[model samples]
Target: MSTLTVILLSIISLMYSCKDNNTAQSEDIKEIKSSEATTQLSPNTTTTKDTISIDKSTKTNTFTSSPLDLLKQNEKAIVTLFQEASPSVVFITTSVYQRDYWSRNVYEIPRGTGSGFIWDEDGHVVTNYHVIKDASKAEITLSDHSTWQAELVGVAKEKDIAVLKIDAPKEKLKAIKKGSSNNLIVGQFVMAIGNPYGLDHTLTTGVISALGREIQSQARIPIRDIIQTDAAINPGNSGGPLLNSSGELIGVNSAIYSPSGASSGIGFAIPVDVVKWVVNDILKYGEVRRPVIGVSMVAENYTKGFGIEKGALISSIFPDSPASKSGLQGMTNSRLGDVIVSLDDKEIKNNTDLILALEKYKPGDKVKLTVLRNNKEMEIDLTLGSSN
Candidate 1:
């Protein structure tokens, strides 16, 4: 064999072997890519890390909890009380008629809002006098969401109470059960239901902080036997019922002592006992039948100017009146008139005292008056007359 032929043969064989090796390597690479694609497309297959994560996510987290406790006795009582009493509560909104300057058209504009309650089946609603004060008309919204126009029945300004009549059906009216305030004691629980700040049917609970409290009415007359409570009474709570533990109306929420015009835990209510008589008189006569002494009393300032420290000074006596029949004298330019120092053994410090004392009596009732005449105290008998 020739040397050149041997070298050529060896080079050709080495080239063919290298080509086959390259082809085999290409096939192996293609298989590896196909396997990777299959692994990615198969939903039944997962990597070890992925399987661990999937198993954790499928498990739900468990939590342990304590059982809820039932409501206490007082709590249950309050709930039941509210449910029974709230239906009798009503919301009152007052409006004033105004005439537009340019159009000259009269229309009603909202004035304010307050609370009231159904007084009887005849559709009589009772509320605070100040709530409807300066208002031309009012609307009463019952707890059942029925609204009705109300007419002014009567008012006792000195008592801070006003009665309104509605034309609603008797079936819709729910008269509140009345309770006695004369038997009420301090520290007894009281629940007040009203619309505070226009939020209807709001209930506030507190104990009677005091009894026999005195508060001024809208007419500046002193309202005796007022109820003081710690319940939350705001602007719109006026005229709502103050209920005792038995869910009976004991008083009517009237005023609150707060500098910021909000409840300060000091609230006042007109006792239901006083309310009964005042309401009866109003319903019967369209006005309070307060007994009249038929004598006009001078102002406090006028009495003070005359060196009178106390007692209600007689300003003038009406003709054919009770005072005239009793010979009660008035003050003259040179002499001080008779000043009532006492009435029926009750000290008459001022006109307010005299007025309050006379409230306990009815017309034609005889009363003894202690008068200061000519710097000497004397007694006189007089018969009370009805202003009605």
Candidate 2:
């Protein structure tokens, strides 16, 4: 054989050997890929080399929720209070009748909404006077979602309080327990339950921010001895109860001092002490039965015109009454009469002050009055008379 022929034979053998090695590498790669694909396709499959194993019994879809801790002492107390006192709270809705100009048909339109509470088992409901003011009809809804038509019983416009009667069963009516507001102190915790924004039975917690605060009623009368709180009182919270820690009503949530018409922490309530008498008088007389001093005081504007800026100026006295018998003089064409400066040592600043002062007493109750006559201060003793 020739040398060139021997070299050609060697090159062909090398090419065949290289092709066999490439085929072996491709088969090995296919086997390795098949194993990996099987591992991914079957999550339950296990491999000792990579040490990857998934238990079929283990569930990643099911969630195990953690337990919640128990409530704290104060939190539990508030919860209990809300549970007990909420039954007495009620939701109030008012409507006004409007006649369409074209159709000449009358229809009841929703006027507003507010909060209220049961006053007695006979279905007497208590709320703010402004809540039902100008309303032709009112309705009361109990905590159980039962609603009833409410009749207007009476209203103390000066105090911004009103009373309504419902025909609900005595079993459904839960009257709130009364608490004294005179003993309330600032920083004392209080809770307010109301239907804010038409949401029924909403609760808010806060403290009494101040005592003896004054607020004006819808009648433009100054409501004195008011309780100021930091509770979140809104427009619908008017007529709701302000309860103390014991779940007794200490005041009636009435107003908020906010420019945005929402709660800005400063809220006012009508003191329960004043509410007690006002409600009682309404139940009996259909109006507040305030004591009469048998004397007419000059309006604040007129008093200011006379240069009397800080006291109630007496305009006239009724004959054979408390003022006349006590020799309380009134304004004369010649000179000024007595300007009441104080009542029972309480300073009187205007006619409203004197009127509110007189409300603190009853008929035949003796009171001492300090008056300014001829620029000289003198004291007078008189017995109050009945307005009736």
Per-candidate total of colliding backbone pairs: 0, 0
State which candidate has the highest TM-score: 1
lDDT of 1 by residue, 151-207 (tens): 999999999999999999999999999999989889999999999989999999999
Q: Estimate each model's TM-score.
A: 0.81, 0.79
The superposed Cα distance between candidate 1 and the true structure at residue 119, in angstroms, equals 0.7
The lDDT for every candidate, in the order shown, is 0.92, 0.92
Candidate 2 per-residue lDDT over residues 156-257, each given as its tens digit: 999999999999889998999999987899999999999999999999999999998889988888898899999999989999999999999999999999
Angstrom error at residue 161, model 1: 0.5
Instruction: Report the Cα RMSD per candidate.
Output: 15.6, 11.3
Q: lDDT at 315 for candidate 1?
A: 87
Compared to the true structure, candidate 1 yields what TM-score? 0.81
